[model samples]
Target: MNDREGGPSGLRQRTRRAVQAEIAATAMRLFLEHGFEATTMEQIASEIGISRRSLFRYFGTKEDIVLGDHAENGRTLKAALEARPADEPPWEALRAALKALVESLPYTPEDFLKITGMLHASPSLRGRQLEKRQQWTELLLPDIARRLGATANTMNELRARALVACALACSEAATETWVRSNGTVDMERAFDEAVAAVRA
Candidate 1:
């Protein structure tokens, strides 16, 4: 197990995080400008002033860099939900967390444009994104299952998966609405409408 307490291990972990952040930021910018498929892992590393081998050590694949944060975000959302007031409902907790998550994202307009374009135009990226979502669902469902006193069986798993999928769908719908409305509809508003649609 990794140690959270301060030590050499902690220091190394922090360094690793900084390196990953640097890599992701650079990769996203390049991917946005050049397109995902056109962007090479070597170019990403070169932009970060690192060797390709070192980049490989940090992220196994180009797709991994783009999709890696889903797992981290899932863990964070879980922890955030757990930390919320016990009286709060699960959906409410998730809603609040989602807003905070968007706020916490370091995405620039350029980054958003790239991701939105790629996700819309590229079937491969969409498929990869779905797989990443599935990975996130797998991480989050076990905790939710335990909370509901249900095992991680197919039915419970499907419910958990559905929750996340609906959330993403709602987010996407809201984004489309925002675009059509000339940015009058912010993502948070869209997310609210999306979640509400799901609840109803």
Candidate 2:
């Protein structure tokens, strides 16, 4: 068996991640140049010098290719939230986590606008975006509950869920405002205000 740490398995995982990133970059370029619906799996594979089957192995569908990084983002958010000091209030921890999430976006504001535009223009992508948000909320719920020291059935658990929801809403609003401003507005500041508003 291969060593678990920084061995063949690690190398393979890194390679896979690299290939996936390349595929996503290539697909985004094509989608932007052409249109999301006009872009095809075969075209993406051809541009990346990979077989169509290989592309399928990395991403099940065109929408998946566009939104694949969201899973990683969710993991990042969860980790950031969990890493917050135990003594911090739940809202404070959540605010920091949401800021971390924004900072972790792999693209610049211009690219974010392009990607968000593409999603807005495509009904399928918009649906997938909502699905991804729901997935993130679910991924974070248990951690939020844990941080609040609440069992599943406790009122504190309900409060934790509500706080998570508010944070998410604030994040969405901040992102939209930033995108609309063409990146002029400060996303972190917007998020901070949003969190503060929720707390009040």
RMSD over all Cα atoms, model 1 = 3.9
- Please give the CA lDDT of all the candidate structures: 0.73, 0.84
Q: Candidate 1 residues 142-185, lDDT tens each? A: 55555555666889777766775676677668766765565566
lDDT for each residue of candidate 2 in 29-56, tens digit (9 for 90 to 100): 9998999999999999999998999889
Error in Å for residue 68 of model 1 = 2.0
What does the lDDT come to for candidate 2? 0.84
Candidate 2 least-lDDT 10 residues? 148-157
lDDT of 1 at 176: 65
- Write out the backbone clash pairs for model 1: none
lDDT of 1: 0.73
Candidate 1 similarity to native, TM-score: 0.72
Q: For residue 196, what is the lDDT in candidate 2? A: 78
Pairs in clash, predicted candidate 2: none
lDDT for residue 121 in candidate 2, whole number 0-100? 72
- RMSD after Cα superposition, model 2: 2.6
